[model samples]
Target: DQQVKQNSPSLSVQEGRISILNCDYTNSMFDYFLWYKKYPAEGPTFLISISSIKDKNEDGRFTVFLNKSAKHLSLHIVPSQPGDSAVYFCARETSGSRLTFGEGTQLTVNP
Candidate 1:
């Protein structure tokens, strides 16, 4: 019962380009959407979050877009840098604060 899925296992982008990570979910009851970035040997760090009521949220070079009807969401990193390379996970939070995460997508930003 994998409610969330990341269709692409990895993504590679040249530095200074845009990096787009996509995710899809089967559960419509989700209340919040979040993206986390994890580096090797490090715990996942909260990158950005979006409420179900909003379609898009932006913070600095990162932006998250949610499409309720499509059950899809995407995280966009503009002017991607080498340091942005990491395993990115997309998660959905249910009513009780339980979160379901998709298989992470490893993003590599090459200089």
Candidate 2:
């Protein structure tokens, strides 16, 4: 079974604070980890990604870390801003056709 789990459906953080989202996967075959940020009805845009070969990947304010042994991953947003408020989805690409996504975690950046 391919199941990606984001236990927290939502999270709120004050602006300029750190925001962290966690995800877990049951499938061991997953090799590509990705995080996508989405606002409202718009399609999700890629934020950062890490292959099973890497432990971490960072871009600007977004950083993702993967622990293959634990089958867990997390996304960290440093000094989050109001504009950063959105739904973050953690996904694993295994089959090459599409990614298996977590339920989603809504990050609210409070001003």
Candidate 3:
């Protein structure tokens, strides 16, 4: 069974608006959460990450919030720019080494 899932296949946000990407997981053993952004023909780049001990982590315009009780997580991008358009993947880390990723969500930031 798929342990992680991204319900929305795509998201569209206007430039300078807030973009919210959602993810859900069924595995309780996950210890960390991460978000990755991928561009055409390039590898996914690490965006933000959160530990299970914390509910939120933020870096500049990127923030990741974890809700262990709800088995959910979200990545928020404030003031999203056109350059931010990319496919975003939500992943859970287990055993500190293995990662389970959700189906990516393509985010389009319109200028």
Candidate 4:
């Protein structure tokens, strides 16, 4: 069974608008959540993260929110720009040095 899921396959937004990506997980033991942005052929880069202790964490234009009780999380990007277009993946770090990742949501920012 897949522990992590990104319900939306893709998202489109105009430049300067906001983009919201949703993710859900089934594993209750997950204490750390992370969002990664990947380009066409490059590796995924870490974007933002949130620990189970906090409800939200923000970094520049990226914000990650986690709901431990519901096993859900979301990434928000405000004033999205063209360069921000990428495939965003939600990941969970397990205690066994393994990271579980969602399918990923492709974001398109129109200029």
Candidate 5:
């Protein structure tokens, strides 16, 4: 079974709106969670991250929230832009360099 999962395969939003992406993990051993953004034919780039100890973390337009009890995490993007449209991936990192990523959630921002 996959340790991490993205429940939503895709999301569509209008420009200047909010985009919410969700993720869940079955393993409690994950120490950190990260969100990555990827474009077609390009490598994924790190977007945001939050430690297991932290309930929430925010950076500019992006915010990440972790609910340890539920083993769930969510990413929020305010004023979603067309440029922000891409495949968003949620990842869990262990003590080692290995990062387990959830199936990506594709976000489309329509103008």
Candidate 6:
């Protein structure tokens, strides 16, 4: 069973629009949730995170909302730009120190 799932492998949207990425988890024990953004060959960079205790966290153009009851989380970007195009990965800090990551969602922003 996939503890974490990114239902869609890719998403495309026109520039200056809203881009939403969704994630679901089967494990309810995940305490720390994070979203990372990666470009091409580089490693993923931390974007936003929400603790199991909180419901939402935001940074600049990115926002991560966690609904603990539903075991779901989403990342939203507004006025999305061309530079925003990249592979986004949702990760969870499980009981183990190593992180568990989603397969990833490739976002394509049309210029």
lDDT of 6 by residue, 1-111 (tens): 438889999999999999999999996776788899999989999898889888988889898999888889999999899998999999888766578899999999999
Better of 4 and 6 by lDDT: 4
Query: lDDT tens string, model 5, 1-107?
Result: 43889989999999999999999999687678999999999999999999978999999999999999998999999989999999999988865768889999999
| Cα lDDT tens digits for candidate 2, 1-111 | 988999999999999999999999996886788899999979999999989889999999998988889989999999899999999999888786588889999999999
On a 0 to 100 scale, what is the lDDT of residue 56 in model 1?
99
Give lDDT tens digits, candidate 4, residues 1-111: 538999999999999999999999995776788899999999999998888899999999999988778888999999899999999999988878578899999999999
* TM values, all candidates: 0.95, 0.95, 0.95, 0.95, 0.96, 0.94
Task: Report clash pairs, candidate 1.
Answer: none
lDDT of 5 at 37: 100
Clashes of each: 0, 0, 0, 0, 0, 0
After superposition on all CA atoms, what RMSD does each candidate show versus the true structure? 1.1, 0.9, 1.2, 1.2, 1.2, 1.3
Q: State each model's CA lDDT, in order.
A: 0.93, 0.92, 0.92, 0.91, 0.93, 0.90
Off by over 4 Å in 3: none
The lDDT, on a scale of 0 to 1, for candidate 2 is 0.92
Model 3, 1-111: lDDT tens digits are: 438899999999999999999999996776788899999999999999999899999999998999999999999999899999999999887775788889999999999
Looking at model 5, which ten-residue stretch has the lowest summed lDDT?
A: 91-100
